[model samples]
Target: MDSLSQPFTFSQRAQKLTGSAIREILKVTARPEIISFAGGLPTPAGFPVEEIHRAFDKVLSEQGRVALQYATTEGYLPLRQWLADQMTAEGDVVSPDEVLLVNGSQQALDMLGKLFIDEGSKVLVESPTYLGALQAFSLYEPSYTSIPTDEQGMLPEYVSSPEAAGARMLYALPNFQNPTGLRLALERRQELVERCAAARIPIIEDDPYGELRYAGERLPSLLSLGRKAGATVVRLGTFSKVLAPGLRLGYIVAPRAIIDKLVQVKQATDLHTSTLTQMAVYEVVRTGFLDKHLPTVRDLYQKQCGYMLDAMQQHFPASAKWTHPEGGMFIWVTLPEHIDATVLLQKAIDKLVAFVPGEPFYAGADVKRNTLRLSFATVPEEKIREGIAILGKLISEA
Candidate 1:
């Protein structure tokens, strides 16, 4: 039969998969003149190109064959040890054996889904959560229970609800959460961990933006708090935020049991992450490079966040409200209940400004269409001002 006449069947998983809303929006905003705030991309200016180049050169020069050769699925020993050390230093006692390197935290999420989720399993998440996590977990066809959230983050009291108590897992992005950019309060973190532990629900703490804090004092991670509460917290972290996303390097730290299972899943998936990239990253970060590098990143993000927030204050309608994030790349805006952000995006694009509508960030059908997300990490100060002004005018007119 001709290709056009061919009939094919697709798996239920494949059928359920939907394109990322932000990615779809990005295609329309690709024109240079469009001031796009739709992506969660880190500033290209923050990449340590020279240092990365030097590290890669050193790795090839000293360990050429080893760098190119296929390595263990568990990842390079030195990198895992380094990650374990860093986690331990951060109050979460971890061992190299408990660390599993993945292509990125995105892959970590997928593998975790494979490890834990089954068809129709219940997964608890924040009301307005990271879209990526929802996408990853949805592949396993889990029923989501979105917990009530606020400026301080997830409400611990909700975890006691019957739906939450019986969930297979609780997915959280506690430190500078994606889309919302809200950090969970310290007390809530402790209480959430304790409650989840009592309910026998594991937590997946995706902390890609933890190190990007600019204004507030650093709070203890859920992984660390989970330890005291006897919760099995699987923390996923990435070098993408601090270094370069093109490298696609991230690590997962968990109990030996979980790490062992995830390693098996990864072996079936991509075997292991690139050996050269892992070695190069280890070489670059081994000698306190991130200590110097991160401050610069934090400073840039802080300034950009300040610029966006200030622009919003000057341009936005008094009826609108938005999160003032202390750190991370995004600010969540809640427009008037009558204004749908999806419709606003099309209008904003006509004015050469674009932002992600926030409905897709939510897991349930009961999403607030008035919400949207703004990312400031890559946009210039002038563009931020210009774009927010345009968006403001559009909202006011609406």
Candidate 2:
């Protein structure tokens, strides 16, 4: 590689953009020997490989030419319709036209940033929200306002903070949010919808983990409530969590007007999501495969989570605390007030265990350095026990 002897003049945005801390760490943890809980990767055991293969074969045989043809920016008709049906079943009463398929929910987030954000625009998010979202939205350089969050999730009440008071929109994860597996209470959802509607602030509800619940009652999405409240809601949904991430399929449901604008932007972004993949995913999931497959996924994750939690209880020092997620890939672990998780990650890597420190999830310096996120979906129960035991011992010694 030729090094630039001259100073390269990168764009201001390009200059500021940095890689995800977790992704950078993944370079080292990619070693097969590492017991990593760093990435929010799904369990390989839960992938519907056989069903996907069958679906792909069928699509290639029956709809060969069309499957390979260029698709509209709005995505495949049947797939969008299926997603609408799924949302309707979940009580959103959506139209297929309102759903625009994307490469993945991550791309949808990028599209949203392009659609709604401007330089210095106020964007609100949960204090310790999904790091990917923060990294995506940062490209547009929106001024972020971190909402106060707790075990109950991001608070929906009035914001007195002068910096965050006039935020244009709130980016929330009401169902098993990443980093912190805290699901927002139904009461909080209702309050948030009503308040945001009254304030004329739109909401972007990112819900990739909505259906993977293993315990407690499944609450209505913020979009569902926002619709009933007559507020603007744009919700991103993905098959990445439930199916395979490699499929790279997801969609966004919003008002048709917003969908129209996004469609134009998307046409300029990428012509469309892979038509073949969308067709195959629809074929696999159309006749109730996820309905059957998800229960097993839920059970596996629940068992793994239980093992980690039990191990944490037995091995972690009393000063450490962790959130109990009902359903999702992560558990948020907060260590003693004095310990920083970023530093602890080095020690964990030395012990052959890895996790994502929570600091990068925050937009700015108002971060909890003592917190970290652990993933249980991919690791086996025995590995979960061993890894958490090692992490707990380290925390105890720290």
Task: List ranges where model 1 is wrong by over 4 Å.
Answer: 1-4
Tens digits of per-residue lDDT for model 1, 195-231: 9999989999999999999988989999999999899
Off by over 4 Å in 2: 1-8, 159-162
Residue pairs with backbone atoms closer than 3 Å in model 1 (clashes): none
Number of colliding residue pairs in model 1: 0
lDDT for model 2, on a 0 to 1 scale? 0.90
**Deviation in Å, model 1, residue 278 alpha carbon:** 0.4
Q: Write candidate 2's Cα lDDT for 1-398 as tens digits.
A: 34366466678898799998988988989988899999899888989999999999999999999999997999999999999998899899999999999999999999999998999999989898899999899999999888888889988874435666677788999999998999999898998988888777889999999888999998988889999998899999999889999999989999999999999999999888899999999999899899889999999889988988898899999999899999998999888889989899999999999999989989866898999999988887888888888988889888
Which pairs of residues collide in model 2? none
Q: Report how far residue 377 has shifted in candidate 1, in Å.
A: 0.8
TM-score of 1: 0.98
The lDDT for every candidate, in the order shown, is 0.93, 0.90
Task: Please provide TM-scores, in order, for all candidate models, with all chains considered together.
Answer: 0.98, 0.97
Return the lDDT, model 1, position 75: 97
Which candidate wins on TM-score?
A: 1
